[model samples]
Target chain A: MLDSLLQFLITGVTVGSTYALVGLGFAIIYNASDVVNFAQGEFVMIGAMVAISLLGAGTPFPLALLLAVMATVAVGLVLEALAVEPARGAPVVTLVIITIGASILLRGVALLVWGKDFHAMPHFSGDAPLHLGSATLLPQNLWVMGGTAALVLAVRQFFRRTSAGKALLACSCNRTAAQLMGINVRRMMLLAYGLSAALGAVAGLLVAPITFTSYDSGVMLGLKGFSAAILGGMGNPMGAVAGGLLLGVLESLSAGLISSGYKDAIAFVVVLLVLFLRPSGLFGKGAVERA
Target chain B: MHMRKRFFGLILGAGVLAAGSSFAADPIRIGTFLTVTGPASFLGDPELRTLQMYVEELNARGGVLGRKLELVHYDTVGQAKEAVTFVKRLIQNDKVDVIVGGSSTGDTMAAIPEVEKAGIPLISLAGGVEIVEPVKKWVFKTPHTDRMAAIRIFEDMKKRGIRKFALISGDGGYDKSGRKQVLELAPSHGLEVVADESYGNKDTDMTTQLTKIRATDAQAILNFGFGAAPAIVTRNVRQLGITLPVYQSHGVGSKKFIEMAGEAAEGVRLPAAALVVAEQLADSDPQKKVLLDYKAKFQAKHGEVSTFGGHAYDGFFIAVEAIQRAGGTDPARVRDEIEKTRGFVGTAGVFHMSPQDHMGLSVDAFKMVEVRKGNWVIID
Candidate 1:
């Protein structure tokens, strides 16, 4: 029983790390701009698919991955400039809807380019399962967890230490005040989107070997990542990572211990409960009033 | 002036005669609605291509029943509502004599009532048993049902002396129906389902379920799902070091499954149509010639030969043969001839339709094949 519990944890953490990366992407964009980028999942898909196509063309693995992430960052920049920037100063809801439209457009374009086929990326490391006591885990799982941790740390440092990150935070807190302080708010927004897209691309690159990649695969992952972001208090990057891991663990344990059929239901129920009890999410600070 | 009037009258008379003669040789319309351009396009695109190619070929060889075949197809885009609308349009506007489409079971089932109401014979390409179980008078299907696939797997297990097995399925429509069939048929086959599990359609990982199955005392594992999920399950099964025999349904019969699952698909068994291993079949096998012929013709035009396309081949020929045997496009006579079909060897199997069994395929229609070195090999 204990061995199975450990096994479930391993599975949960592996799956959750991908969600954390995607959720972190959501958090980053949400912090920089109040518009929830529904297209964040498509960034993951584009990253993985571009890498697969490059590898199929006989490109080296590392270079293919690098180019793929860069391509996805370019796609994110294009999306912001074309779809989001044109609608600057629009209501956040409209911007969110625009991102949703952009996501659909991206999916359609991907379908036309790649067709409707699922692609598998060669594992970064060997596929031999690593044994831990009575439990087993794939080397890819370690890459996902480790990659997510490192990226999370890098993102946190960018926010806390870097002047540009501080400027972005200032924009998130109050755009007018940050602009008054000579911060180029638009460039900061662009940086946030680029960084978020890179994070999403890495998540896709890490998980593609395990889950396979397709044009429409982003739809569900994007929703789950959105849920993770909300569960982590919407705009807190670290909180989104924690929420992602927590949600993954809950799904895995419930699937292993209770019933696999109810796994998704139980996980979402917990998210709902968390939202009901604390509207700001598990890690969000409650709203403050200045009288 | 009189000479000019007489010449005009002659020209008008020739025009009338030409139009009347052409009307007598009007083509027989075969209307179809397939999911040719959507997520399920993988199934419907090939089906539409097969129908078009065969119709062209048949017309070149002096058409069915001395009348050229007109294939009028609508891309349903894998939507059932669109399928119903297209079926209605085919019946009302196109004025087709026979229908041979419906790429997925949902599309097929939604179009059934319309076909039955219009009294037109529909040979569906989808694989749900429910489409033909209650014996809809106007509906017949070409593909083997999910029930037959389950029975085939169970019989194979029973022959191997394996008793208890676990079933892992997806929550998709096809997967749910397949799981239900396995559970319903397990008892009669002297098999016991030790554990039952399911995952969402878009689930990225299934290790939790695989771990649960690993802890079980199951003698074998049967996964009934389509798309990329089964491949993931196969890889996870290998990753977790579970060596029990892994059996998949016909849903993963395509070469893409082997490509996706990689080395993990080796030795994995599934019951699929004979078209998958067409070149490997012995000369004495009855389906060898037909399978190879269709494969060559389709590959020359399209890129690959999918079982879904083979389903269309069977459905189109069945409609054509029934029209020929009926002596005309009389709806009732064509429906009767389709029902009386017996030993009509096609791509899927030797179809034998009857009043009670609209599908007209037994478990023998499926060939038990295993993935060997990234290619399909007939094992049973």
Candidate 2:
């Protein structure tokens, strides 16, 4: 029983680390532009698919991964220019609908381009099973956890230490005031989308090896990541990370102790209960005045 | 001697004319509806490839008794309703003389009434003994039925002295039917099923039911989910450290399952058709040659490992043989010829059909295999 708990933790955290990475993408984009880029998941899908195609085409793994991330960031920038920019000053509801529509378009395009099939990327690390006492850990899983933490820290430093990052942060805090103070809010928004998509793409590439991925896998991943964002309180990046990791760990624990059948439900239900008890989330930005 | 030569020439010319006249009127078209994309794409891709191969081979040999054969295909995306709609389109627009059904039993089941209404032979490439339950005369299956795999798993378990077992399945149509067969058939094979649990394909967690399975006194586990669910289930099972042997349904594809299972997939037994085992079994091993040829040709064409699509390939080629035997695409005659098909070497097995039985397989055709280093090692 104890070993199983540790096993679940390992599996769940590995999965959650990817989810948190994606959730951070969502939180970042939501914070910057308030567009709620529904196509966030599709960026991940594109990354995985591109990596797979490249790998199949015999491109080395690292090069293929790099290209996939760059390609996703490019796609994100294009999405901003084509979809988001034109819809500026549009109603938030319209923006939401448009982004959702964009998500559907992306899926359709993926299905057509990639064909409807699931792909399993070659594992990045060796598969030699590692046993620590009674529990076992996969080497790739360590990459997953470490990569996620590093990304979170990098995102923190990027926002705090960089000048352009500060401008973006100011925009998120007060878009009108930041613009009045001569911040290029529009470019910052574009940068946010690019960065967000890059994060999702990286997550997708990392997760693809462990889990079989299809054009449709993004829907579930996107939903879970979105839920993580909500659970962590939408605007807080750190909260999103914590929520994602927590969600992953919690789900695993329940699967260890309770039932896999209800693991998804258990995770979501716990989130709901948390919202009910503490609407600000475990570490969300404190309650705000209604507009 | 001169008179004899004239008579032989006369008969030859007459035969040529008859063949030419028949060709001018209508070519027999076989329309297929299957999940060409999505999780089940593996199923339809192989079936379609086999159908194409049969068509090419038949056309090259003499056009299925001097009439050209045409094939139409649709990607159903694994939705049952989509399959039915595609079948309808094939019947109405394409005027297909025969219907080759899809990769999924649910879609095939939903497509059956229309196929029967059109009175065309519907050769199914999916499992789910239910497709043949009502005994539609126009319908036939080339794959093994649920009874074969389910009972085989039980029989094999009993042989291994695993009297007590547990079953976990997806609540989807085929999985549900497969689960039912295990429940109804296991006891007869002397395996006692201690617990049964179900979940859906979209389900993210199967640990709850698996936890229940862990608590049971079952000597082994019988698994019946497909795609990601099975992969997740296997991982969860290992995570929970319930070391009982797991015997998976034949629905578990080799590449998909092993990858999904990761390390936990080691030592898991799954029922596979002779197609997946043909190379290991023998080159002159009849069915092995066909499957090997298929695997080679399929890879050459599609650039991927053959999965459950192998079964699909077998079903379709056998159907082509029927069309070839029938001498034309007459629906009634094709159905009759398909029913009379015997000793037809295919990817799955040497198929033999009778009027009452659609699936040409018996318990003898399946091979039990385990994943070792991402390869299938046949145990039985």
Candidate 3:
């Protein structure tokens, strides 16, 4: 019984870590642009597909990893320039719709480029499971948990210590004041897009070996990521991480203890109940006022 | 100016008349709505290609019933609403003599009411038994039903002296239907289901479920899901260090499943059509030649042969044979002829359609196969 408990915890943490990465991607983009980029999930997909092809073509794992992240960053830049930037000054709803459109377009393009097949990558270390007392965990799971932590810490450090990150935060806080202070608000949006894409790509690469990759894999991941972001209070990075991990644990425990058929329903019900009790989410600021 | 106008009008009239006369020998129209662009594209793309290839070959050999065969296809994208719209167009606007497609059970079930009202023959490529059960009269499917897959796996397990096992399934129509059958039919097969669990369609992890199954006294595990979920389950089972035998459904007949599951797929058993191990079948087997030919032709064009496409191949030939036997493009006649089809060997299996069995496939259609060194090998 203890072994099963340990196993569920491990699975929850591993899956939750990936969800946190995706939620962080959502938080970063929402912070700068005030528009949720639905195409954020496609970045994860692009990273996985690009890395797989590069690995197939004989590129070293490290080089292929770098190239995959760079490729998704470039895609994010193109999406901003072609889709989002063109519609500058649009209403939030319009921008949201455009992001949704971009998401569909990216899915179609990925299908054309990669075709409709599932693919897997070799584990960075090996397939052997690490023995936990009375339980086992794949090495890939550790990679997922470790990589998510590293990315989350790196993002936190960038926001806290770096000037460029501060400028982006300023844009999120107040566009007019940030512009008056000589910050390029538009540049911040582009940076946010790039950073979010890179973060999502990292998430993809970290989890691709375990979940495998397919052209349409992004759809569900994107929905869950968006849900995590909303559950975490919409635009708070720390909240996103906490929300993601919590959701993952809840899902795992429900499947293990309750009915597997009701696992998803239970997660959604809990989220709804939490939101009903706490309208601004667990960590969301309560109705901030501005001048 | 008046003379020139008259001359141009005359030329246009003559052109129209010539076109009308030629079109009076109108070709037999075959329309299909397939999941060619979305999550189920792995099934629909190949199904579409097989139909296209077979139709082109037929036209090259002087067309069906001496009228040119006109094939119209639309991508349903694996959405039920998209399937409804496209299937309506196929029947009402395209005026196709016969229709084929619906790559997933969801798509197929969604289009059933529309097809039944239209009264046109529909040869479905999906594998849900609900698509044909209770004799819908106009709907026929080519793939072995989910119930057949369950019975085949249970029989294999029973033969190996296993009576109690666990079942892990995805929450899809195919998986649900199979789960229902397994639950209902276990007692008949002298088997007991020790543990049963289900996962969401998009779930990426199954370790928790596997852990629970591990604690059970089930002798083996049989998974009933389509697409990559099964692969994830296979991987999770191995990751949890469970050594009991793992069995899968025909939904995962492609090599991609093995590739995704990596070393975990080794020793996994599945009940699938003979197409997966086509090259290993004896010459005396009836399906061997048909399977080899379809595989060769498909691989020559698309560079791969998936069993999902083979389901379409069977559907196409079944429709064509019916058309030829009916001797015309009339929908009613075609439907009648299709119901009369029997002993027709195709890629999926030797189909024997009837008024009672629109699916036409029996449990024998599924061969027990085991993954050996990353390749599918016939076990018995």
Candidate 4:
């Protein structure tokens, strides 16, 4: 019984870590740009598939990974400049619709290009099973969890210590004031969006070997990551990570302990119920005052 | 009278020439419609690959009936309405001699009326018995009927001394048909249906449904869903730590399931087509050799595993066999030859199609497989 419980925890924590990465991207983008960046999952998908294909084609894994991340960051900058900047000062609903539309467009593009097959990439660390007590975890799972933690800590440090990172935060807190103080809010938005997409891509590449991904995988993953963001705390970076990991782990545990049939329903219900109980989410920045 | 005779003679000559040209070198075009994209793609994507592989093999084994076999493909997105349109295009625009495909039963069911209108041979890969029921003259199937699977499930459960069972099925057409079939047959197998829980395609939760099911005094669970749906079921079954025997439909063989469900999927029983289970059988067995070869070849080419890809593999190879046997691409001749196909070793098993049994196999064609340590293990 204890062995199975440990097993569930391992499974949950592993997937939860991936969710954390996606949610972190959401939180960072929201913090700077005040846009949800609904197409975040596509970045993850691009990173994983592009990296895998490049690696498969004999490119060094590190080089492929770097290229995938950079590619998404570039896409993020372009999307912000072309789409978001043109719709500046638009209603939040408009931004939502446009980003959702962008999500659909990205999905269509991925389908057309990739030709609809789930690819297999080699595990980041290795394929050897790691035994923890009675629970066995794949080495790749550790990489995902470690990578997420390191990313979260690095971002936290960057916001506190780096001048540019501080400028990005200042823009998020008060764009008008930041602009008045010559913080260059538009550039800050570009940086934040770029970083967000890059993070998503990194997460995707990390988990590529463990989970199967195809062109159609992005929408559902984006939804789940977004749900984690909302559940964890929409604008709070740490909260997004916490919420995602929590959701992933809870989902695994539910499937482990109860009926696998109800895991999806169970996870969503918990999210909805949590929202009802605490609107700010487990770690969300409480209610925000509209500018 | 002389003018009339000359005109009649000219018309006859023209008809004979036209017929002769059609018989000469023009490859008989076969149209394939499948879910090459979207969420249901896991089912169709491999199917398309298998189809491509078989077509290549047939071409290599000497062009079918001394004419090249041409396959025109389309993506159905696994929807019935999409299938209807695709079938129309296949018949009217592509001018195909035969239409084969249907990874999803709903799509196949929708394509039937259009195929009947075209007066062409239609062989479906989807396993819903209703697809052939009130049987259409031109429509045949390569997959065993869902009714056959229902019987096998109940019989397997009964054999294991499971007198009580619960059902967790999606509200899809195939699921509904299979569930109804199980209800009809379970009683004969000395099993009582304790509960029937349902979910929709977009549903992200089945906790309430599963909770209700768990409350019942059932000895086993029969789950029917595709993609994340059944994976969710498998996880929930584990989370609840329900010790009941869990059986999932073969439709859940997507790449996403293992990643999502992980260890919770261990020990789940599935009514797998013989093609997949043959991997666990002894190497000395001829069927095992075929299954292993198909798997090895498919993995080498496609780099992933699919449960029902063998259906598509079987479909393409069987059609080629018929074309070869008929010695020509004449639609009627090929159709008759296909109907008479017997003891032909296929990826799935020896197919024995008759005038009545167009699918060429039954429930017995499937072997029960269990997920053991993250791999499939054949059980009897």
RMSD values for the candidates in order, in angstroms, are: 6.1, 7.2, 5.6, 8.4
lDDT of each: 0.90, 0.78, 0.87, 0.76
Full ranking by TM-score: 1, 3, 2, 4
lDDT of 2 by residue, A54-160 (tens): 99899998999999999999988988889988988897788878878888888998888986656778778865546765555557678878889999999999988
TM-score of 2: 0.84
Clashing residue pairs in candidate 3, if any?
A: none
lDDT by residue for model 1 (B50-117), tens: 98788767755556776767778888888899889889988998899999999999999999999999
Q: lDDT for model 4, please.
A: 0.76
- TM-score for chain B of each model, two decimals: 0.92, 0.84, 0.89, 0.84
User: Which digits, one per residue and each the tens of the lDDT, describe model 3 over residues B1-380?
Assistant: 00000011233335545665332367788888887765566788899889888877775555677766777888877788888988898889879899888898888899899889989999999977788877897999998877888888988898989989999999987788889998999889999999999999789999999999999999999998988899999988888889999999888988889899989999999987889889899999999999999999999999889888998998888999899999997889999999998999988788888899887777888889999999999986
User: Chain A TM-scores, one per candidate?
Assistant: 0.98, 0.96, 0.98, 0.97
Error in Å for residue A1 of model 3: 2.0
Q: What shift in Å separates residue A141 of candidate 4 from its native position after superposition? A: 12
What does DockQ give for each predicted structure?
0.75, 0.30, 0.81, 0.09
Which docking class does model 1 fall in?
medium
lDDT of 4 at B110: 89
Q: Cα deviation of A102 in candidate 4 (Å)?
A: 5.3
Worst 10 residues of 3 chain A by lDDT: A282-291
Work out candidate 1's RMSD over C-alphas.
6.1
